[model samples]
Target: MTETHAWKAEDFAQVNAPHVKTALTALQLTGDALEQGGAFAEIGCGTGEVARFVAERGFEVWASDASQSMVEATGKLCDGLPVTAEVCPAEQLEFPEGRFGVIHSSWVLHWVTEIDEPLRRMARGLRPGGYIVLQWTGAHPRSEGPGMFGILRDIAGSPKWKDLLAEAQPGSYEYPAEEVAKVLEEAGLELVHYEPDLPHPFSAKKTMADLPEMRERYKLAGFATQAAALGDRGDEFVDEVLTAMIRAGKTDPHHARIVARRPAA
Candidate 1:
């Protein structure tokens, strides 16, 4: 079974909405892509924000997530729209061959136990010349000085948190842009575009005034992973990490976007 993340669906939706919107805009999916679709699927439709966005554009959407709460939340969010919410994981997605004209995933692929099989399934599920857009953490920034997650990760790896790290689930998988494109091509999709860095509106600039806002955002932005690694002391750990980041003026993490197409029949 896929392990449930330590996040509530509502909390995730509230925290990730802006980032999701930014990703959709970066892919330029707000216009014609929605209008021309046969069917659209969001692989990890947390709270269904992106699904609803596509459905609002008049596209039929199948939104799936491993978490039942998330699926239910998606269903509630997408009510009255042409959308179906299912509790499905990336590895076990059950779509008929060539069922989708467009498939979209945001920050979800790295959770798969094995990447290739899911990519293959997605490739087969796309209709001829269909598009698949994905956004994921390509690489985390690690510099000589302390930064955001890097500091958190270092703290987690320390002897004080050794027991917690041993019990925590593995961290998300990240790959370079070239490797990502190669994987897509090997899965039988033509790589249309691959961007290693996709910009977001969030400012990395740290100010004493923004600390509270940053703390809240961190809680929602996969900091749960680090929190899990710190066990009951997670909050305290994050507080220190954020303080360190602010002191060092660390920026937000970078994300990658890939757009690929299945070959025409």
Candidate 2:
């Protein structure tokens, strides 16, 4: 879980335009619950694409991200739209009583260490009868290969570069289904809708919205150390990685999506 993401305001919007579809799906699932759901708060707003969409639909939106750059980018993108962007961590953000009706955190929780607490906090923050939609991705099975990390792991473990990448795990994280359910139950949230293991393939061809920007992504994707270790061959290493990704059309990513509501007290 090292620094694996490098996002700029200009590039993030385009590179992540694909995420807007998932954002729409979340909103579509929320439906009328959003009307009664009070203020809409989005954690991990990224470049605020989702926040902007939610605001365009007329809900008051407050967006937060761990990166100040991201918060600023969100603030800028969502400007003139009923949105407030801030810098905060999901676990640390206060979900005061009766404040938010729709609490949404998209594609963000897996980056966190303790997935349970954030769910608890989002649940606790919700108004009674308010709905919470939490979508966390990344449960990459180590066995699954040519998956993004698998390719990187193989390259790092290859005889040529093993020493430089002894401890490299580009994108290694797991979010088990049972743990997610336990957190929901613990928080007293009523089960509304749950979709698990939606595969998000990492096809370099499709994912690379801007080839030039994405070329820098290996660094952003937590290959900074290895890239640096490659020294004079760093550019060559980037080419090699990109070639591998292109050859492996799909990274076979696993995602967990959930929509639940706090029972009216």
Candidate 3:
């Protein structure tokens, strides 16, 4: 249920390119997945930056997004690369069984209601011994504790965020490591790696690095319909939260990241 609002390629490219690169570097994929060479799929291929990155390293890439504009933009970005782009939900992917050597999704899984079905699909889509890598924002990803949300709530007051906090309730997505291992096992994926890492810090003043940006991303992600329903007031709430976050960053930085992998064999 990711939001869609005529997103342009530039918007995503601007917001994620740096962060994605940082995440990718931290993952240290080492081009092993790319070397497998059957098909590599990236779920939530916003602007196709990560897809293109892997494509350049030699994987024949297949990428999809729920957003039509994002799909179109991703296609344009992968215009000449060895990548194919589609607009579809993870649950509806139409590739033949065992078609991919690698599957990837970056910063998008938090929007999912439950990852079991999609992970099942991904496991089914992989060739024997294929790899799956996912990088996403967790409760603490990109922020310290309650991270940016704490700042936003402080400035905007409790009323504005009460609804969002409820919607963003913990464990709605991104299971704890043990739970993730269980989900993968249930989905027929062998857990090869599961690690949590702190993400690079963001500056509200320098990069609009605050809760409003975070909320807008979630709104576009379509998972925050309840929060979006709050409308302009929701936006104002974000601003207030950002203001508070900026003040806090002046005192301490926030960090957030969740990285994991499954190898199908």
Candidate 4:
């Protein structure tokens, strides 16, 4: 798999604001948290919009991401904005125990195959009663039927590719709030709130909140590499997938948000 993405620091301009809105809505952040001394951290803070939003709300913000491009972009976006940007992956954070009043993540935890370890690490970093707000893709099919990956597999005549994706963990664990709460409780986090029905479009015409972050995700999910391998038929393959998504998004929507908190000791 190609670890580095062909993306620019400025390309994230499309995604920052919408994600900031989503994070703020999910966090239910109040003006009270805007007071001085409130500390907040965002994992996978691309381009630093969310960090700036929290910082503006009066919380000291720490933004981090694994991608150097993302980290650099975030630093530039948050420059002179009372925010700290760093290159840190969710699994390993360099911070003292119980340092943050709020821990927020946007469309990040899912990329982590080992979800539990990161949650444990986050728990260790959160102050008691601090909230962890997350907006992520849930278990849902991209298309009405077999999905784009399935179509690509058929076109390329490869059973292995189909099997790999079919076996891939569905977009998410697809558990309800109580189920998520159980996981959090076991990890020493108290269940505060979880809602898995936030509907967002996979693709949209404008770059406004109408579009979910799936535009970049689909390409990054090895689709671009596979398309390149498909040779001359790549253009047709992408068109077919996009046509299907346009049709599906008209009738079905797929997106969600989940929030939990570390208990006060």
Top candidate on TM-score is 1
- List model 3 lDDT by residue over 1-265, tens digit each: 5533334555556566566776576446524655555677888888777777778877788888867778888788778899888777665666567787777776666556676777677767777777667665543332334554444334434664665555443222333344545666776666565555444544223335445556565444322433444556656654554455555553132223333344433
When 3 and 4 are scored with TM-score, the better candidate is 4
Q: In model 3, what is the error at residue 123, expressed in angstroms?
A: 1.5
Stronger candidate by lDDT (1 vs 4): 1
Error of 4 at 63 (Å): 1.2
RMSD after Cα superposition, model 1 = 3.5
Each prediction's RMSD over C-alphas, in Å, is 3.5, 4.9, 5.8, 6.0
Query: lDDT of model 3 at residue 37?
Result: 58
Which residue pairs collide in model 2, if any? Answer: 4-220, 37-101, 202-251
TM-score of each: 0.81, 0.74, 0.67, 0.69
Number of clashes in every candidate structure?
0, 3, 10, 1
Q: In model 3, where do residues sit more than 4 Å from their true spots?
A: 1-7, 139-174, 202-234, 240-265
Total clashes for model 4: 1
Worst 10 residues of 3 by lDDT: 251-260
lDDT of 2 at 246: 55
> Tens-digit lDDT track for model 1 on 97-126?
998989888878656666777777788888
Whole-model lDDT values for every prediction: 0.72, 0.68, 0.58, 0.59
Candidate 1 TM-score to native? 0.81
Worst 10 residues of 4 by lDDT: 167-176
Specify the highest-lDDT model's number: 1
* Lowest summed lDDT window (length 10), candidate 2: 1-10
Candidate 2 achieves a global lDDT of 0.68
What ranking of all candidate models by lDDT puts the best one first? Answer: 1, 2, 4, 3
